[model samples]
Target: MSLQQQFEQAVTDSKALPERPDNMTLLKIYALYKQGASGDVTGERPGMMDFVARAKFDAWAELKGTAQETAMQSYIDLINSLKG
Candidate 1:
């Protein structure tokens, strides 16, 4: 079992939880999306996401405070989900 395999298994297990993402979890997804949308993650390159997605991402980021690891894990789980 490699590190990547372990991570994938974790996300798969996490997604089956009763509460996939609480309020805080949603916020982290928004934050990551915002950073990606705003080009902050990509150095503000013009070829990033469109304006609408960026706006949505920002809105999502504003929904929670910083101390939300559970939510953050949900977001990570989501990203991992996309791998398969």
Candidate 2:
């Protein structure tokens, strides 16, 4: 299979991670997932009261310059590192 297919499979399998990762790692996973799936952040930022949404949005925004393929590969690498 191709690298992107492997990466996509890894992303699907990531849902089975034995334990939840730390905040930073979770943010990274979320950001990379969004980047890989959606390309870039869109729409307005969430309100302050919506902290979780805001954080996710910010995380994705940070990865604005990352290429989709790069983000997918990074996401797979991160899941492997943490799962091991």
TM-score of each: 0.33, 0.92
List, residue by residue over 1-54, the lDDT tens digit for candidate 1: 644455456555555655556554544555644433232332332325576556
Top candidate on TM-score is: 2
Give RMSD to native, each candidate: 8.5, 1.0
Candidate 1 — number of clashing residue pairs? 2
Measure candidate 2: CA RMSD: 1.0
Residues 1-84, model 2: lDDT tens digits = 877887888887789888989998899899999998889999999999999999999999999988998988898888888777
The parts of candidate 2 lying over 4 Å away from their true place are none
Model 2 lDDT on a 0 to 1 scale: 0.89
Give the top-scoring candidate (lDDT): 2
Number of residue pairs clashing in candidate 2, backbone atoms closer than 3 angstroms, sequence gap of 3 or more or interchain:
0
